[model samples]
Target: MNIRITLDGKEIETTAGTLLVDVAADNGVYIPTLCYQRGKPCLGTCRACSVRVNGNVMASCTVPVAEGMTVEVDAADLNDMRKALVELLFAEGNHNCPSCEKSGRCELQAVGYEVGMLVSRFPYRFPPRTREHVAKYIWLERDRCIFCQRCVEFVRDHETGRKIFTIDDRGTHASIEIDVALADRMPPEQVREAAELCPVGCIIAKGVGYDKPIGQRKFEVKSIRERTLERSRK
Candidate 1:
């Protein structure tokens, strides 16, 4: 069954129970996502995909499509809010993009560019954090983590289904933890998967850095919007 909803004043027809993010994307509307991976359970952890539906703000990935719903994805106020959200993330963490290895390929950085964030309105936290290089294949630079929870929810031990990355503490003091036993046993592919799953440079694969170079990185060649919209076109 299909449902019709008005997105940014354009009527979009999509399957019932389809996430608003997917519905918008299928119709060429890009909702920025930081913690969403297609086919995975919606975590709603990042809240980067927040959009107005029926005059109320909600995470697009967590909202299901319904008939006659009015969504405001391109509204100016929402865009401002989105930019502020990006800036907050920048200010919250120690994201020194210039010196970070994930500078160009980082989704958080790309989203910052997408939202036209020149500077953060809020003061930078610059919270003290510790780095861990316990695993032979991977390292954790805790300073740059945005607490997106991707590694905690997605990456797991293949044999025991135990989480390799778990959250420690709560709220502002919360930190990412690794199950050393499981992390050490991770296969090479899983090692790569964990590194790639992180949206920032917090999760570093030990041996490689600056592999793609400055100009030839993921978002350096094309904007995140262009990359995503092109995928929808195909």
Candidate 2:
């Protein structure tokens, strides 16, 4: 079931119907992603994974490989598109990575660094958001959320499949919520899972965070690009 496609001027052979993200990674092409994880349903909420396919911009995680397709993952315009998406997320929320507990390990911050985003192109809103602390093990910091919907879709009630996180309001006023009653019943692993699911610092585990010193945390040691691109160079 091998299919051939061209990526950035090079020919790549991969299985048909394989996700473009997986195909790119297998062929030493790195495409940034946030809301798409292996084995989980893709939300495509964040357009960070966009790549140009046959001259059209598409979310790579949602597209499958096709024979004779020409995929562009490293075009200048596509890179700028990814950068703009990251910058918009920064301007839309109160990331404040320097003061946040998830500073070094935060994916959004790592992505900003990877994309060379020195400053947000859009004006900062500094929008006021309420924090939810009702959950015993996990809490919500609305200001840091990017509405990725990872927890809402993946971290459901272990038994009944009820949503543990949801959204309220609409558009600019919308915010994320945690089902306190259901969250309280979540096992310790699920509590950690929920916190880790967040690409930003919005979802936090009560007893963790702020423990790692600066320049010593996950992404701090090695940037996301280094992790993704270095392997390709090998």
Candidate 3:
């Protein structure tokens, strides 16, 4: 069954139970996503896809389409809220964009550009976090992690189907933890997949940095919005 919902003042007819984010994207609307991956269970950790649903703020990636639903994806206030969320991530994390290996390819950096974030309004935490290269194939740069939970939910041990990445502690002391044994057992392709799954440079693959030169990176070839919308069409 198909349901009609109003998105950014345009009525769109989409399959019932389809996520609002996908519905909007199918209709050529771009809603920035940080932790949400298409066809996967909603983690709802980043909340970058938050939009007004029936005049209330909700995570679009988690919300299913409903009849008569009114979604405000492009509203000015909503854009400002999204922009602030990006800024908060920047202020909370030590994201040295220019120096980071994921510079041009980082989704956070691309989204920052899309949101027109010149500088964070909030004070930078600059919390002391050490880089971890203990794993045989992975580099753990804790400072750049935004707690997106993508690695925790998506990347897993193929044989055991168990989580290879997880979070430690809660709130301010929270940090991402990896099962070194499971991580080491991961195939080379899977190892690269884990690093690619990361939105930031946090989960870098050891011995793989600056492989793609300037203008050849993921987001560099085309803007995130363009790439996302283009993907939606295919």
Candidate 4:
């Protein structure tokens, strides 16, 4: 059944219990997201899709629309909050965009530009993180990982149905761990899929390096906003 909701002060009719983020997107609203992928279970890890629902701030990807729910998506304060999240990610991680392999296609970089992030307000930690290239077909660039868990949750061992990528430790010491044996056994296409699944340049295929020129890259060809809205509608 279709239910009416107020999104950015505009009336929108959508299916009841549909995810708030999808509802907004289907109605021509753009909510920046990192961990939440459409048609997949919501991870709510990134918290970039924050929005006001009935005067309460929450992750829109994890929220379900209710009748007459008032949503504020285009508010200045909300945008600033998202901007801070993006900036903090930059400050915490070693995202050297110019030198990184996924500079143009990286979602973190794209979202940062979308949120108007000139520079991070927080101090850069520059934590010592080592890049892993031992896996036969994949490279784990720990420095660029934002811990979105898309690979850990979505991409799994095809036959065993076990998590090929897992998180080690907890809190500040937490790190992403990949099963070298499992990763090696994966088919070439699956390896490429896992690499592409990552939001940043963290998990990458070994053989492929700077394959597409800068101008012909993913985000360069079309803005994240355009691709996101196009995907959401589908």
Candidate 5:
């Protein structure tokens, strides 16, 4: 199926199932994303990839292309919306980027910079922190979760092949939960993958802090798109 869409004022042709992010990238109009992973399920929870489709804000990761579809990437209002969303995420979580090991490489930090979010407008919640100690090598920080569910989905589908992780509670109290009460039940490699899959530093490897150093990290030299494409090829 063929779809003709106007992206950033240029008409482009794409397939029916093409995601808005990929479409924009194919046309050299990059749409910022944090929760979206290529070749994975579309979570659409992170509003960072939200774009103006015809006139309304929608998650570009999940939005399908259609014939004659008019889409705007990085429009002023859309950028403001994205910036506000990033700020809200920052305020809701314990994202001390400067102190985090994932500082320069963190997707949240990169997106925040791309959207020009200098200071958070919303009051900080400073919510009580919680941690999940999984063996001696993995820890899950509930306070930093933006509820992206990349970990939950990845662990459930890719690693365990079972519904091991789930989101519990609702609306500001929602959290990721493991099906088993015991921590470290999942393999260490799988746990590592899940932690790395998280867009933010919500989940982290237990002992591998700052091993690469500041000058050697992937994000330090390459854009997120470049990094992501490189990973995809590998």
Candidate 6:
């Protein structure tokens, strides 16, 4: 089935069931996404890849290409909306990129720069940090969590063949929680992988400190589109 959609004033036709992200990428339209990787599962929890579809803001990762769909990739309102979302994430977490390890190479930082968010308008919540050292090889910093559930999704559904992570609260207090029973027995490698999958420095490798300098990180090499395309090709 062929589906035709208008993106940023250009008409593009693609096969049905194609993701909006792939469609936009193929058409050279960039949408910043953190929880989405090319070869990975689509966890629509991150609102970063959102776009205006016929005047409605929605997550492009979850939206399948539809015939006659009018998609606006860079509409000013959408951009502002995404920027505000980024700002909220920053205010909620302990990003402090200047002192963190993933600073220059962090996806959250790169997305902030892409959307031109120099400072957050929302007052910082500065939530209390929870440090869990169950793995010893890795430390889980709950403060940096955006509650994207990428780690939970990857660990339980993708790698472990079981659901070990889940949201433990509701509304603004929702958070990613690991099943303590399973988390105690989970392998260090799996924990480390989950930590690495984090777009922000919420989960940090214990001994592996920042290896790259500020100016030489991968995020500095290309725009988010180029990076996403490169990952897709891999």
> Scored by CA lDDT, what does every candidate get?
0.89, 0.87, 0.91, 0.92, 0.77, 0.78
The worst-scoring run of ten residues by lDDT in candidate 4 lies at 167-176
Ranking by lDDT: 4, 3, 1, 2, 6, 5
lDDT of 5 by residue, 1-234 (tens): 987899888888899878887777776666778888877879888878899899877999998888888898767888888899999999987788767767777788877877889999999888886777654556666767888877766666444377656789998787776664333566777667776787777677788777677767757778776664455445
Tens digit per residue, CA lDDT, model 3, 37-90: 787899898988999999899989999898999999887899999999999999
lDDT of 1 by residue, 110-181 (tens): 998888899999999999999988887889999999898999988989998988899999989899888888
Please give each candidate's TM-score: 0.97, 0.95, 0.98, 0.98, 0.89, 0.88
Pick the lDDT winner: 4
Tens-digit lDDT string for candidate 2 (1-234): 898999999998889999888788777777887787755788989989999899899999899889999999887888999999999999998989778988888889988887889999899999999899988998789999999888888898989998989988889988898889999999999888888888899999998869888779989898876676665456
Question: 116-231 in candidate 6: lDDT tens per residue?
Answer: 99999999988776666665455666777788877777776344578766777876677666666666566777767766688887767778778887677777766565787665
- Candidate 4 lDDT by residue in tens digits, 94-134: 88998888889999999998999999999999989887888
Flag regions of model 4 displaced more than 4 Å.
none
Against the correct fold, how does model 2 do in TM-score?
A: 0.95
lDDT-wise, the better of 1 and 3 is 3
User: C-alpha displacement of 219 in model 2, angstroms?
Assistant: 0.8
Q: Worst lDDT window (10 residues) for model 1?
A: 225-234
True lDDT of residue 31, candidate 1: 87
Off by over 4 Å in 6: 157-160, 179-192, 232-234
CA error at residue 152 for candidate 3, angstroms: 0.6
Q: Which lDDT value does model 5 have at 180?
A: 48
Q: Residue 174 of candidate 4: its Cα lDDT?
A: 78
